[model samples]
Target: MGSNEYFTEAVVLDKEPSGEFDSIAHLYTQELGRVSASVTSARKILSKLNSHLEPLNLVQVRLVEKNRFHVADVLKTGALDRQHLDALKLIKSITPEAQPDPELWHLIKTNLNEKDILSILGFDSQFAACLGCGLKKDLRFSINDLSYFCVACYDRLL
Candidate 1:
């Protein structure tokens, strides 16, 4: 049989330096859910793989399935164009290399495939509101700590 290749959206979870030249990518594929692959090194100046290797980028890569890992050939990239490339560059400049937000990664990959960026952002924002008798929009909650109400509402919850 011929090699199988996939055309799907993927989010970078983690990437590490493999062997002497190659690097392994822990990718979350829309079609396969989760997969691990070793990408060829883009060491030379003319390498297109250099730009495709960054984490947090929304990319579509063509890969041939192999015994050990899904071998990949990066077809194209820059989902966000040159005008929007500024946005990605800004985001990368602030975020530490090699780390990704697990929750955001999932949210981004799913929403991106569905083409519903606003919906996901809105849902995550409004879901923070607490279930209380008289709550306003200003009500603050820590999405991390699960803190949803003031001291008074905590009493009612008891």
Candidate 2:
């Protein structure tokens, strides 16, 4: 509750070792979107903060936002399967740092599956058109035309 610290839920999207004892973490958070955080002494065996800092583990974190965010403590953790972890890595690659997208957050929270995430990876003109037109339901992707049409749009085209 200090002025320098705030609490929110986040998922560890990626991480890199910092020096020998610290780590830099990429987090996608419910309240702040994507954030890069410094975890002090994360490589030390005695560091209690290391356990909650794995990729794809949703955690409640206490973050201090000064020059950059720093992880003060991890209060809770959530689970995901291996497939979900892979999909999250994909999301991290395409997502802009420090930008918050609630739609993407919802997708990660509820609709993550191999098929759903694969489509995101292969997203082409057709997929873009469907999303642009708000016709993502009943999707029929036409490779030849490079377009996607919903049932109603297809019927009209016919």
Candidate 3:
């Protein structure tokens, strides 16, 4: 797809530093599933592209499906996070994989207050751990990240 054609709303998750100017961004969208795409001339000075690629903000992206996801370009962007910038930051921080997380992410997005969402995602609210010992919880950070521990296991501290 060209500049005019692309997916629906997407929020930038994570991007890797590439060379000196380009970066690859991971996005989660309402329409498409999880995707990561690269954008060049993003890190350039005086470029508005910097403003468009922010966490929690909704952006219109144009992309093409290759072996890995590719972002051809971003069309128009809008601010979507009335909840707060801090909430988005917290989600991005604890979420190691960014896109593939469904449960915790959903919990965050559902919360009305960004601070509350951040609380759940941060170290303070006991969100960083599974409720159990090593009781057969999924260790994989990117896929299926839900597991809970019983009170006995919690009391045992094992």
The candidates, ranked best first by lDDT, are 2, 3, 1
lDDT digits (tens) for residues 1-158 of candidate 2: 33467688888887788887788788888888888899974345416676777887888988898777898888546866677876676666655676667766777788775445436446543445453356657765543344566767766665
Order of quality (TM-score): 2, 3, 1
Q: Name model 3 segments beyond 4 Å from true.
A: 1-5, 41-46, 82-146, 149-158
Comparing 1 with 3 on TM-score, the higher-scoring candidate is 3
Question: Which runs in model 1 stand beyond 4 Å of their true positions?
Answer: 41-47, 75-106, 110-158
How high is the lDDT of residue 73 in model 2? 83
State TM-scores per candidate. 0.46, 0.67, 0.50
Model 3, span 98-156: residue lDDT tens = 24444444553465354454344443333444445544333222212233344455444
Whole-model alpha-carbon lDDT for candidate 2: 0.71
The whole-model lDDT of each prediction reads 0.50, 0.71, 0.53
- Number of backbone-clashing residue pairs for each candidate, in the order shown: 0, 0, 1
Q: lDDT tens digits, residues 6-112, model 1?
A: 76666554567787877776655556555667777455621466357565555676656755455456543444323333323322223333233454446553433
Scored by lDDT, model 3 comes in at 0.53
Query: What's model 2's TM-score?
Result: 0.67
Looking at model 3, how many pairs of residues clash? 1
lDDT score at residue 63, model 3, on the 0-100 scale: 67
Highest lDDT: give the candidate number.
Answer: 2
